[model samples]
Target: MYNSVSEKDWVEAAHPVSQNVRSDIAGAGCDKPYFEPLIPEERPDIDSPYFVYFGRIHEDKGCKTLIEYFKHFKQKSSNKVKLVLIGKNFMNEVDTSDDIIYTGFISDQKKSFYLQNSIGLIIPSPYESLSMVTLEAMIEGKPVLVNGYCDMLKKHIELSHAGYAYFNKEEFCDSLNKLFTMTEKEKAIMSKNGIAYIEANYNWKVIIDKYKYVIENITKP
Candidate 1:
């Protein structure tokens, strides 16, 4: 499959193939960020650590990949790692494991709690037409570790210096190890970079200027 496309078609979908084609070209273009606003009631204590997975729970979307790798990560690290699975089930018996919350189709408020609290996300999809999950992850200001196979997210991760993308299950495990290995200094820097990248590129507030250019050009005679 082609890895990229023109900017024109990214947001301008003339037909069904339009969005898919645009996703290739534009690479999660200036879509809205997925950061959830924090509510007072559900905010976890600031010190607790967690990870989240948002989007469909289908096989291709990497639900299984996160489950298996997190199981291994839990075995390898003493750090408390909570996995919040947010969305409807796309398969059967995804897991029977510790600290795994399969909240079937989370509400908006619950989603914001997870978004505000979690360390980051594990997006292991081998293939996606386009990952709205990645878009939201970056928007939410959470770092993401996705699969290298998803060319769309790979481009964003590389361009925005946002997060890591593992190629195989082993690589996924290695990514987990790397996260644990990070010193507070390093994590802080990466977190700064992540937030900076979103502010500059993904945050809808700053980059809506892109739309003006798009509109100017598209409406030009």
Candidate 2:
């Protein structure tokens, strides 16, 4: 995520990415004070529910894997849950069933709205440096199903208790089943936990203060 590798610099972004990096990467990460964006709803057909994904559709993102997983899930599930892909359709060449919605890059407001309305998020990247959408979904008070293979993101998920992660079909199925079984109140509690983690750890103030202290101590006066 660094534009420069030789020397370090600080950034304050409109979203929670900087906040996450700041908290996790020590003094190297810093932020300017900013208010949190308000969460909005934009999910489609919440009654039947759908699994949402936000990113480029490519092999790295495991689009085929997700498509397969959801296909199996729909077959097993009592409800007809759909998989909504909201990004560039880089995987159009890849053979996938008709159930998946290729939304091909939605706006921020539209994405947030989708996030708000989805049952959960599914991100199964084989290798991901950092997933900003993970933090974004958490801020929206939604639980996600992620690829826990990476130590960094897995650690974040473990620490924050924001969501679940699984390697393959069986584990993913189990996790999804568990999620589907959760009562609305239980889901709400998880959402609350995610929001709290974001506020305390991913908010700009908490991140910026740490930067202030580090800069104060490192000056060449």
Candidate 3:
């Protein structure tokens, strides 16, 4: 099985492709076993009201765009929200101040600590093969703001209704504002929607069942 429909299509488009070959796409499963639910005391002492990015601070991942837009959003918006990045700094562009904090690389438990309490997850990558980080965020019941240019990310938001997908800086900033202003009930609904989507689509049990079915079919006499 392929990790994404895009990968499946690309494989099919290769020169001298065989029509006899069949392909199916499945998203990467969440690491729910590693991310055990945290008690309040176990949570980190990080400041509140922040959005998080959970991958490399590289240009290809759209880190530059996310950082620029977030700073822009902060400049105009009165709310004292922040942007927390929880990955290795590859780009070296971030100033690493309170408004845009960068925690080089941290443990999974600490990553969960930040993600579980953040305003939402932001994935601005223009390319992704079914982003595992996005699935992780959703499984944690947090809404996501993803790049609309990435088909996989956009499809996740579309299928799940758990967040927004922005194509440009204006939309990105606007989504940040919207997420910040949402009422508790609205936020809860979005959170619930994300959790339900992840459980139905990317849960390990469901993914394992899919693999079993595929294996059984291929092994049939």
Candidate 4:
């Protein structure tokens, strides 16, 4: 089974035996997938200009890279953009800068609060089967910044036009600046696009329907 279309393609290319298996792609659904219910209304504080990064704070997840890129972004951009790091820190090294706020292992409620209000969400992981947090952010009509190396994440951004992706330090910094400078109208459009994408593709009802169809076909006599 695959969680994303990109992952399905990867398996088909990398493993010949995958052709024999009954495989299907069912993306991970978001906590609140539909837009009709709408996100719990919360006033986003305009005074605070910060992007949020949630997940395990480790090198593989690209936490270090995010910090470095943000540092560079701060140097280049005049806007006082901050980077809020959420999740447990496994690394020993730390920065004492006030610009980077580390909130280690927050509750789901707090996580949602941040996701709904932040400028955007960042997932710098080099690899991902399917980053559910990205979808969660989308549910809140929040744009995302993803690592270009992760094909699945990149595909999400491309299909939804919900955010940007970066491959290198230069690209990362450039994308950050672009996100920072985006107008309120532009951001709103991207956010709405993201929500629509999630509702159509990653909702639990849609995923279950796909799974049911696949199963019924396989079970047919």
TM-score of every candidate relative to the true structure: 0.72, 0.76, 0.86, 0.87
Q: Residue by residue across 1-221, what tens digits does model 3's lDDT show?
A: 87766566666668446766555666667855366777878776676589999988998899988888888888888888989988888885776777888888998888877887799999999999788888888887889999999987888899899999999889999999899999999998998999898888777787888888888889554
Ranking, lDDT, top scorer first:
3, 4, 2, 1
Candidate closer to the true structure by lDDT (higher is better), 2 or 4? 4
Largest lDDT belongs to which candidate?
Answer: 3
- Candidate 1, RMSD to the unseen true structure: 5.9
TM-score winner between 2 and 4, please give it.
4
What value does the lDDT take at residue 61 in candidate 4?
88
lDDT of 4 by residue, 55-172 (tens): 8999878888888888888787777778888899988874637688887897676677777668899999989988989998888898899999999999999989999999998898
Cα lDDT listed for each candidate: 0.66, 0.69, 0.84, 0.83
Worst 10 residues of 1 by lDDT: 18-27
RMSD of each: 5.9, 7.8, 2.8, 3.8
Candidate 1 residue-wise lDDT at 149 = 80
Residues 1-221, candidate 1, lDDT per residue (tens digit)?
22233233343445346332322132334444355566677654445466778888888787887788788777777876668788889887778555677778867776767776677877777766556666666666667888788766666577666678888767777776676567777767666676666566545544455555566666454
- Stronger candidate by TM-score (1 vs 2): 2
